[model samples]
Each structure stands twice: as C-alpha cells, then as structure tokens.
Target: MIDNRDPLSRLKAALQVIDSQRKILSDSKSDEMLVRDLSAIVRYLNSMSISQASHILEKAHRRGHDQKKNQAEDFTQAYNLNLDDIQSIIDSENVTRGELESIAVGRFQVPKGSLRSIGNMEQLKMKVSTLVQNERSHQTISKLAGDHKYK
Candidate 1:
C-alpha cells in the first residue's frame, strides 16, 4: 500500500485522480471545457514548487510502469528497434552521456540509482542484451506451458 502521509504520494494521487476523470470523458464526444479544465489544473500543479510535476507524470503516464513490464524494457515502442540496430547507431554516432541517460531514465523509466552501477555503453548494452534474452526465454517457456498471462 502507498503511504497516505507522504506529501509526494498525495500529490501523485491527486494527479492520477485528475487523469482518471479525463479518461472517463474520453469515452464520449470531445468535451473541450472539461478537458481544458483538467489541463489547467495540471498546469497549475506544475507551476507549484512543492514537487516536480514530471515525477508525478512519469509514474502516471509511462508504459514502463505497467505491472507486467520491466522498467528497463526500452525498445518495445519501436517496431524495428533491436540490439544490432542500437549497436550500429552507437557505433556510427557520438552518443553522449546525456543522451544515454535520457534513454535510460526518461524513456525507459529506469531509476537513476539502478543506472549508476552501469558505467559505460558496453555495460548497458550487455545488460539489455541479457534482459532481452531472458525475456524471450521466459516467453517461450510460458507459451509452451500454456500460460495465457504472457499471451
């Protein structure tokens, strides 16, 4: 359970509540006033200094936070992205530390603390390769065992 006493948690919860309300409206025709109101509320909250709005949005909006997905699953959004594709890009380009950090943290939702242990591109690539291999193996096993959860 989430701690109710934490201010950050409270703020996150509030944002999620607003988001759910918006989701409900999406089932019907576009309601500009209501949608704008929700967006305004988000803007107001973002303007506040109590906490970074991104921290809340990251938890609420990102696919990586889905219960079944691992946080480090980065390339699922791409139809064609793969290990060799990424490797080729890295080899052909001067990928900076900042760019790597953004992909790891911003896109993948990988926690900064977890990324600290991986000090170089080679380490990150190897870690991802291992993860993908394991995931494929697990999927194959699940399919063979008729585990519909994976399907």
Candidate 2:
C-alpha cells in the first residue's frame, strides 16, 4: 500500500502501480478484463492532485527539450558543421553576399548547380540562413509571450 501523505511519493507509487497494471493488461487474454484494467488506470491518473499533475508535466517538458538538444548536437556532428557557425547565421538579420560566397565556394567547395540540383551554393546558403534567422526570431517572440492557461 502507498503512503498518501507525501504527494511526490504517492505520484511515484501511482506510476509504478500503473506500469504493473499495464503489463498485466497486455498479458491478459480476455478483452473485457483489458477494458476494465484500462479504465481503472485512467481513473487513477484522473484522481491525481494538481501539484502532482504539474510535476509530471514539467518532467515531460524537460525530457522533450533534452531530446531535441541531443538530436541537434548529433546532426551538427554528423554534418561536420560548427555550432557557432549555425548560431551566427541564426543571430544575424541578413548574411552579406561576400560571406555567402566565402562559405559556399571557399569553405564548403560546393560546385555551382550542385545544391538542390539547380541552384548555386550561395543561393542555397542565403535561403537557409534567412530561414534559420526567422525561426529564431519567432521562438524568441514566443518565449517572451509566455504560456497561457485557459479555463
């Protein structure tokens, strides 16, 4: 039996109970038994306190952010691209033509008409940089606006 005094402990106990119940439900042969178990599990979760629900939501939010950060790091490593270079592109309002030429021809050595099977490297880089900047700006605005809860 779980001690109901401590909210966090109770939350953990509920999760463990749910996990065990799910395993049993998966192994059950009868459809009626499965339905009953599933309904019980849903009722248990629905009975959780607001504080417990918030804690669970915060944990999920942090996990999602960590996953996205890990994926971005992996992509940067796989492509042999510097994080600073990407950040610089995102921070800048507009990348000059000279900088684009330097990156495309001098740095990457991407041949003309090689990018997107038609466009030149400079054109592709410019488009990509602009898109990144716009995305960054949008994220900044959203963060400033903050999250809103509706009744």
TM-score on alpha carbons, each prediction: 0.32, 0.34
- Kindly provide the TM-score of model 2 when superposed on the true structure, using C-alpha atoms: 0.34
Computed on alpha carbons, the lDDT of every model, listed in order, comes to: 0.60, 0.59
Q: Write the per-residue lDDT of candidate 2 for residues 44-130, one digit (tens) a residue.
A: 776788697768767877899997786555444424544357547534658544344334433344453454452554556665565
- lDDT, candidate 2, residue 143? 81
Query: Which segments of model 2 are wrong by more than 4 Å?
Result: 1-30, 81-151
Model 1 ranges off by over 4 Å: 1-109, 147-151
Of candidate 1, the 10-residue stretch with the lowest lDDT total is: 71-80
